[model samples]
Target: MNAQTLSVPAAIRARRTVRHYRPDPVPAELLDELLDLATQAPSAWNMQDRSIVVVSSETGRKALSEAAFGQPQPLEAPVVLVFVAETAAWEAANTDISAQATGSGAWNEQFTAMFESRAEFHSLRDRGLIRENAVKNAMIAATYVMLAATSLGLASAPMNGWDPELVKQAIGIADRDDLAITVMVTIGYTDAPPPHPGRRPRERTVHTELYAG
Candidate 1:
């Protein structure tokens, strides 16, 4: 089905955390489109410090499954997308944040010069904050992928049950100190629909005005 046919609300309601998938392989072009859609998710200062590893080969999938402590979803699905956050993206100073802002006409030369100082402050004084920001932005992109996949008539499962060190080694990014493994997503078609565990009511989770503790 085309994206125009599936409304965002419909896709959100229909999405399920699929655990089992048919052996059918996802098309390369379709996966590319999905990835493109995912990158559209907003990031801090438009740094977009996220990277994805697409594991479609049997060997890669097996390695990822092993790293994930034998979780069968990675093995069962035709494609496993691994999201990573490059924590050191801010180190680039002008390239990561300033260039995007200037190119998009969102900032002028004066603002670009101003942002460089702010970026330096974060890199030097708020390293931990930068890392946290990267992980948060990456997770948002991963969520976008799941919803976009559902819209395109595919099933997805967002997995967090995995060894980060082993996952990095399995995906051959263990040497990169700046990259943090965020989440793994299994994508493919599912025949048996899993039962939906209903969500909690809004009042139970959302707090109005001042959070009444």
Candidate 2:
């Protein structure tokens, strides 16, 4: 943990969409710890169907910024984490997932067998559904990385606007159709930042038992 680590709530409160950044390089050891914590984000069936490409080189950052429609955040931040959704990862790792689940007693062998064979499970295995779930997993992991960055006395900015095709080509995955670029998060230090924009009212966004319009 960083010496100046903040609590979860404080981190959330302190986080903002920072674009400009100081040129100081983020320590590799700190970045590794941040990723170790980021990847701890939960995934569907613990499939962990996501991969991150850390862009630190000047050329890589320039390419990513171009992919992100010339967004300055990617171009300026010391590091940009490209979150990728590996749609085919789950298909090839089911056996391993089931074995681990059963091994850990999280799922019994018989239940794992039945779960894989059930019609309900089959319904969720379509290509589109699988892709959507994979992207969701990637987004969760990105959020974890962003929050982790803030907690570690670092700044981050999540960039959602980008050309996926361009991103794939930028990151050297143009040939892999099974992988999708879900999101990008820039991590670095900032000198000055504007105030948090603040969130919408809880009553307007959150709802109990049943959602109310």
Candidate 3:
């Protein structure tokens, strides 16, 4: 099926966790397109902190499966996407952001100086906050990938039950202190679709104006 034929609502509704997948490999061109769309997802200060590693080789898949506590999805799917967050992205992005702002005639010298000062202070004094924000940014991109894959008639399963340290080692990034393994998403064609367990109603989840409860 063509991705252009699917509406956003249809894609969202059709998406399901696919634990079993066919042996066919996802085409490289399609994968690249999907990733490009996934990158369109928003990030704080346009930092674009998410980094993805595509694992398709049998050896790499085997290692990732072990890291994921022997989950078969990693081995069964033709491609496993590992999303990592660069916690230092904000620091690296600050200069370019200021440059772009200036180039676009949106730059405020005083504001830019204050923002950089605050960002540096947080990086040095509030490391935990920076890491948390980076993880959130990465997850947002992962969600986009899942939805885009679904629109392209591919199956996907997002897994979080893996040991972070093991995953880093499996992906050969164990020594990268600036990066955090955020999540893993397995994507491919699936013969069996997981049952839709359904979602909670808005009344129970959404709150209007203020929290009534």
28-141 per-residue lDDT for model 3 (tens digits): 888998889888898766667788999999998988999989999999999999999988776653687778776787757886776566565376436557887888889999
* Model number with the top TM-score: 2
Q: Against the unseen true structure, what C-alpha lDDT does each candidate score?
A: 0.86, 0.87, 0.86
- Alpha-carbon lDDT of model 2: 0.87
Full ranking by lDDT:
2, 1, 3
Residues 80-179 of candidate 1 have per-residue lDDT tens digits of 9999998887667546467767889998998788667665546643555767788898999999999999888889999999989999998998899899
Model 1, position 205, has a per-residue lDDT of 82
Candidate 2 deviant stretches above 4 angstroms: 114-121
**Model 1: lowest-lDDT 10 consecutive positions:** 119-128
**Tens digits of lDDT, candidate 2, 29-68:** 8999999998889997777889999999999999999998
RMSD of each: 2.2, 2.0, 2.5
Regions of model 3 farther than 4 Å from truth? 1-4, 100-115, 118-127
Looking at model 3, residue 98 earns an lDDT score of: 73
Name the candidate, 2 or 3, with the larger lDDT value. Answer: 2
